[model samples]
Target: MVGVSSARDRISLRGIRVTAHHGVFDFEREQGQEFVIDVEARLDLAPAASGDELAATVHYGELAQEVADAVRNDPVDLIETVAERIAAVVLAHEAVEETTVTVHKPQAPIAVPFDDVAVTIVRGRA
Candidate 1:
């Protein structure tokens, strides 16, 4: 199998929202909030492009569900952990040579008014 490179093709899923309990605060763990996930999988797309077959590429719908399940079912204290978990899930696919996962915590309990806080992680076969 080929490894990932800067110019590799990518399949991405963005703005996937899920409600999960993930924070350092007690209120955040108890009350749960919306978490947005974005994923980008990099790999050689020549086969899929020429074949025009679903099996030739990563199934994005299933990948999205996996990411959502990881966010909803697992309770972690940090968004960094969430991002790591998402990256693992995305890299599990055989066709995915590499993946970058971003976990967005929009409603985090911050004293200052901010738009959002997020963590991004990249993982794959080295």
Candidate 2:
């Protein structure tokens, strides 16, 4: 005989805005832009559920702080690269089984007015 049990795998955060100089053109970099970051993660919950400890699971607050830290410190030319970097950082955590990062850039230097430009990527432990 065998027994089946449920497990949880979800972590998410949203609306993290960071104003930074990130772009290809000199003017765009000088002027800066509004970046909105959204992050989601998935991991096994057995350790956390059993011990009620943070060390056993992915800490969403810490992940958000890391995202803010990366944007504030690094100067990248593209949101795609930003998303990739964020995903990499999240996946680096041993407890994180998978992660997704979305970086939104509004008020770009383009002549046209649009909602926003963004990139979303998903990464998993390999």
**Against the true structure, whose lDDT is highest?**
1
lDDT of each: 0.89, 0.81
Worst 10 residues of 2 by lDDT: 1-10
Candidate 1 residue-wise lDDT, 1-126, digit = tens: 455453469999999999999999999999999999999999878787678988988888988999999999879899999898888888888888889889999999889999999988889887
Candidate 1 TM-score over all chains jointly? 0.92
Which candidate ranks first by TM-score, i.e. highest? 1
lDDT of 1: 0.89
Among residues 3 or more apart in sequence or in different chains, the pairs in candidate 1 whose N, CA or C atoms overlap within 3 Å are none
Model 2, 9-122: lDDT tens digits are 677889888888888999768878789999888777776877899888877788888888777667889888888888888888887778889998877776877888888998
**What does the lDDT read for residue 72 in candidate 2?**
68
RMSD of each: 3.1, 2.8
Error of 2 at 60 (Å): 1.9
